[model samples]
Target: MIKVDPDFITFEGIFAMLLSIKSKTSCGPDNIPNVFLRRYAESLARFLVEIFRSSLSQGIVPKDWLIARVVPVFKKGDNAIVTNYRPISLTVSCCKLMEHIISNYILNFLDERNILSPFQHGFRKGLSTTTQLITSIHSFSAVIDKSGQTDVVFIDFSKAFDRISHSKLIFKLNLLGLPSTIVNWIKSYLHSRVQFVDINGSHSDFLPVNSGVPQGSVLGPLLS
Candidate 1:
């Protein structure tokens, strides 16, 4: 078990995290753009640091931060059919700053402990899909040259992100021995989120989002 610093969310760390946010990204229902956040990042870092620390300690994420604006985009088939569209959430960027820092801490901790597999290539540092493809191709060629046959299998799931079971995810996280604080915090984050679907500039009534992580959140990929 690694003994990590309790006060990890420093002002400098917050500033660095804020600097990572793209200025032109779409804002959520808060209507507070990343550009607006970055403009005052120097000033907000101190305040955000405290909020992030409090959030971590309490394992209670701000309720307002959990809200999202879900926009449905047309997906190939008929635009008239509701099934032809996919829902994507635009979560608040300020809330995302905390997620970015938390994700960094989790990744660094896992890496330091050698928790991740060396063979894993997706969404990792110094690796890309192209690199994986080239390596795989070379391996296949070498095997073919040595013997005579090679076989490959591909498994693709449609909307795996949207389809994950919350309970199953929590179970897996616990099974993997993630910190209790992080698990509790993730539970708080995943529960009670509300989203309003925007259709033709008109929004549907607010609905409870009981499943899936916020689509565009920094934590989304991690949870999924």
Candidate 2:
């Protein structure tokens, strides 16, 4: 995961982040919508900045921010198969704005240090699965052109996100040289998180989220 300087949460920064929110984003368990944030960004920026600063300074996220609403989205395969669906977590919009800012800082940190491998084509800006696939094809074609057959092996981990250990993730972040304050703040953000599955106007009992970053969060991909 990337690191951030909590000081980056300024009035202008918060205002810009609010404006960046897409109107179509679904509300989290807090029932706060993105369009409302964009509409009142000017009026709300100051208060949000204060709250963000306090949260970072104290190393404690607001309890409400830790809650998520999980919506299961179907993927290819039999509809009856539970594994065919992926959990899309909807979190508080205000909390996501802070995440966006922090993620940008972390990206900068990684870029400046040349920490991310050049071959990494997923998640990073300007890179995607399609790009990686194209690169692989080109490499294979070039090799075959010279009559040098290429052997390729693909491996996909099942429930990769669900298997991540929070303690180990924290340790990896520390080894990456992130500041102690930022690390502590991330710990607070990860722990005590609770979520309930929502489907067709029905909600399940709130379950404690102990491990793995949920999908559909600003920091989930970055953290993974």
Candidate 3:
């Protein structure tokens, strides 16, 4: 479990976060590559810790972190169709480290309080679609053995991730009784974010992202 300090960001935590970043991953609009951070983790740790501590205290993140570079990836079907493409956003590497720290703290808090439902299998460690399927099959088999009918329904919604409401997500987090500081920081992180599409060597104008968490964000799954 990750130890939460709530008020300060530790150098060790920041260093670990920097070292954990994959070197091959693409950088965001800031162009501060992951390899750059990972290779210089030792020298950068203290600086990042101070920045993160200030950010947490102010409930604000650096504006550069709010900018994302979006790459459209084809997901089967017709590639020419816009709906068949999903955006993959790359955000500032250092900001992602801070996000990871905050996410771990939040996850630890939720786990200790049993805030998440047992039925939730996605975006959770040691659980996935396979586990959910096995659980469902066991229930169905038991019902069938008792000479009873069983019914199953599977639903897949398109653009599900892109449709999440920021306001509703914040409301739900508040309802879960998360700390006001964390909630406010998350609000600052989500709102006023901007992304620009990058295709080949060309880049589009940055547009304000008013809804949905960035596709490749550390906090995206949890917020969703």
On the 0 to 100 scale, the lDDT of residue 66 in model 1 is 89
lDDT of 3 by residue, 51-125 (tens): 887787777878888998899988899888987888998888777888887788778778889988998887777
What TM-score would you give candidate 3 relative to the actual structure?
A: 0.90
Answer with 1 or 2, whichever has the higher lDDT: 2
* Candidate 3, residue 185: how far the Cα is off, in Å: 0.5
The candidate that achieves the highest lDDT relative to the unseen native structure: 2
Q: Which of candidates 1 and 3 is the stronger one according to lDDT?
A: 3
Residue 224 local lDDT, model 3: 74
lDDT of 2 by residue, 1-224 (tens): 44346677789988887888889978888898788999999999989888888888778988989999999999989999988999999998778887886677677878889999987897788889999989999999999999998987789977777777899999998899877767777889899999999997799999999899978998888888
Query: Candidate 1 versus the native: TM-score?
Result: 0.89
Off by over 4 Å in 1: 1-6
Order the candidates by lDDT, highest first: 2, 3, 1
C-alpha lDDT of all candidate models, in order: 0.79, 0.85, 0.83
What is the C-alpha lDDT profile of model 1 across 1-224, one tens digit per residue? 22234387799988877777788787888988788778888999988888888887777889998888888878797788887887788887767877876677777767787988876667666777888898888989999898968888899877777788888888987777777777777888888889898766799898988787777677887777
